[model samples]
Target: MNNDIPKAVALRYDRELEDAPRVIAQGKGDIAKRIIELAIENGIPIHENPGLVDILMDLEYYSEIPEELYQIVAKVLILVYEIDKKYTSNFNNFLEQKGGANT
Candidate 1:
């Protein structure tokens, strides 16, 4: 069996208009580390799905995800949305407690 370093793929979606998400960034090994780090720093949600990453890694950056991957990606997007909602709610609550209105 061959062992490979871990990989990561990042995606972007525009819910207002776009029909599909696009491959925003992807990398293996060190670059993968950086992508994950940046995501964490920016409060982006990260889903660990090596199988999905394997499939998405083949796509060119900025290319729309294929229809075959829509179901999987949809699940991930839902998770991200939920996380974002929770974070926003928490942040707003924090601001209110601090006597600062949410902007």
Candidate 2:
């Protein structure tokens, strides 16, 4: 793959729903752009790991990530969790500044 074009892989994980994270989507170039755009539009966190993406790209869509990647993926998940926590904090602060949530 050309390094000039961006690559992306989207993983979906739900502890009660699946044993491991699945590759919900993967693409390069235009498809990759759309994958990223959708993630941004839906407020999903994005992490960059080109080597990991390369390995994941070899896996079939909707397949669980391999055992070998568990540690690496776990780190990514931790980062995503932190990102979510920060975003939630900022959003709550924004709401409080505006006189708290309506509900």
The prediction achieving the highest lDDT against the true structure is 2
Give the Å error, residue 46, model 2.
Answer: 0.7
lDDT (Cα, tens digit) per residue for candidate 2, span 1-103: 4798999999998999998999999999999999999999999999989999889999999999999888999999999999999999999899898885465
Expressed as tens digits, the lDDT of each residue in 75-97 for candidate 1 is 98898889889989999888888
Task: Please provide TM-scores, in order, for all candidate models, with all chains considered together.
Answer: 0.82, 0.92
Best by TM-score: 2
Quality of model 1 by C-alpha lDDT: 0.89
Lowest-sum lDDT 10-residue window in model 1: 1-10
lDDT of each: 0.89, 0.93
Each model's Cα RMSD:
3.3, 2.4
- List of clashing residue pairs for candidate 1: none
Model 2 RMSD in angstroms: 2.4
